[model samples]
Target chain A: MSDIQTDLQAPLQTPAQPSEDSGLILPRRSFLRGAGTLTLSAAAVAMLAGCESAAAGTSASAADISILNTALGAELEAIAAYQVGAESGLLQKPVLDLAVQFQGHHKEHADVLAKTVRSLGGKPVDAKKAYDFPVDKLKSQNDVLGFAAGLEKGAVSAYLGAVPLFKNRDLAKAAASILGDEAMHWAVLRNALGQNPVPVAFVS
Target chain B: MSMRPIAADAIGGGPRKGAVHRAGAALRRLYALPLAAAVMVLVIPAEAAAAPDPARGQQIYDRCLACHAVENNRVGPRHCGLAGRQAGGLPGFDYSDAMRAAGFTWNRQTLDRFLADPLGVVPGTTMTYDGIKDDQERRDLVAYLLSLKPCAPR
Candidate 1:
């Protein structure tokens, strides 16, 4: 598994800026191997592959499953958040329509995540019936929209955290796509609430 | 010529010769095998290494303009002084709780991983798009992102 730092409470520190001359240097150049070396390389690669599966296979999958569940939990939370907001009778038709559509997206995410976990031979976690959102805090349409935006933002972060951990490239991309939709939803809702739609440059 | 008896050491530590030794040599070629893989199982593919192509990164960065910007606020936060910027530290942008919670500093390694698969690395971030899968493209893209003005020192 890739060495990753995903702790949510780690103190924010100033990191070095990106540059070819400085910061993290990613090794992307392919090795120039001789054609005669093919057989030898293949043998080494094969042995290494076998050993990898035998050793870290179990722990790697467990980590992947755990991250997926975290994402899945976020999706369920978003769904619940929307459900409560939609039923609050506070949003006008336009906003309510948006909320329903956003809820649908979360549902799609939840199903996909559940399926992914099951595909990995892990049991999918069930969603909670009710989330502990601050219902009493919602006093106006702006508050409701702000709350919804917050939820979408949280979902975005959850998906982002999980994106790098997925062993499958396609699954990583899928998570990215979902993140985009959630960001879009958050921006639109923020606009509705008169908050700055775009908040930062590179999302954490 | 008389055939020599096969030796037990011939399978591995012995000199490289004979058809059987040749087969073992394939797996034993220390030069071909990655040193790290020997210790750990599968090689993580190449995690991160590349030269920056800001021009290419610039081209690809167009995809991010919908939400992100170089210095000004758009649908997302400004990219000015992004280098060395703390995760979720932008002043005015209302970052996702997940981003705000992630305590990290942007570097080639973290950025590359995230660019390869945004969600795989960060999980709850709102930035969308399938990650740049190609190693060159990813490095270039991040190099370009790195070129953006970094935040001012406090």
Candidate 2:
């Protein structure tokens, strides 16, 4: 959860200007910095029920809810990142269109996360009045794409961490399904930035 | 009032029916993966082997080292048992829907095509590695990966 704590403390890093030769993107280090971020869904509800059934008032169930709430917070933050990019007024045409589409996906992610949290007896975290996004760096379309791509990659990693955490194999599969969509979003955004869409044999 | 996932596993008969979600199982499995470092060492050797420049393959595998492991899940599933395994066949590994239904074996030819263009081969795969362009590098990397064992995670 330190990753969430870190997200609250500061905005994403400003990647350097593109290299002339390889054109690599020095992605905002903090955005997808850690590969261990969590992303659970209904484990909150189902696990809580299982724990409650097994033990009346154990802190173990609370811990499960806490993980789910944190995952929900990650989704809220992701949706906000998309909103900030979409409303920045710097995007136009295809970029604008793509932003809306990606935002829609985040909304889907948010909807599922929220519903799971609510059903599990935990309150979903609300988006802050304003997030600590790298808003100042939204100077150009490429910057916007870079920022968006960075968060998409972050979500991908977050789900990667979260998927295996699920106690329900179905929920685990669900998280992996979302991870794939997030990866798809990452690939398209990178492609638009003239970055290599598939940069490795495995995507981290 | 039960809510189900919108993205159903049409081919796999729906989200691995009765799959258990043990808490901390992944963490426990990871404890046995100290050999992951060995995979890195085993993965990339420029000329450590007088063997068939498959030694060159390990160097090319550097790009893959980010998301894959010889053991368990990272941003991608572990590559420990990749050779001859059915696509998306690893139990407990969360594979993309596209990958789960890919219905192909991970032999030399299929892996080569997927390595060349992951999106082309598995239309909706989430693998972010842009395909390896060089034919030789792809071949070599696959060879090295094939030589590896799954090293069961706990």
Best by lDDT: 2
The CAPRI class of candidate 2 is incorrect
| Pairs that clash in candidate 2 | A39-A162, A167-B21, A168-B21, A198-B129, A198-B130, A199-B130, A200-B129, A200-B130, B80-B150
Best by DockQ: 2
List TM-scores for all candidates, in order: 0.42, 0.43
**What interface root-mean-square deviation (Å) does model 2 yield?**
12.9
The candidate maximizing TM-score is 2
Can you give the DockQ of every candidate in the order shown?
A: 0.02, 0.02
**Candidate 2: lDDT over CA atoms?**
0.53
Candidate 2 residue runs with Cα over 4 Å from true position:
A1-64, B1-154
- lDDT tens string, model 1, A34-149? 11122212332233233333324344365566555556655665677788778776666566776777777677667766766676666765765544555666655566777676
Interface RMSD in Å per candidate, to 1 decimal? Answer: 23.9, 12.9
Scanning candidate 1 chain A in windows of ten residues, the lowest lDDT window is: A27-36
Model 1, span B62-92: residue lDDT tens: 4453334465443345666666666566775
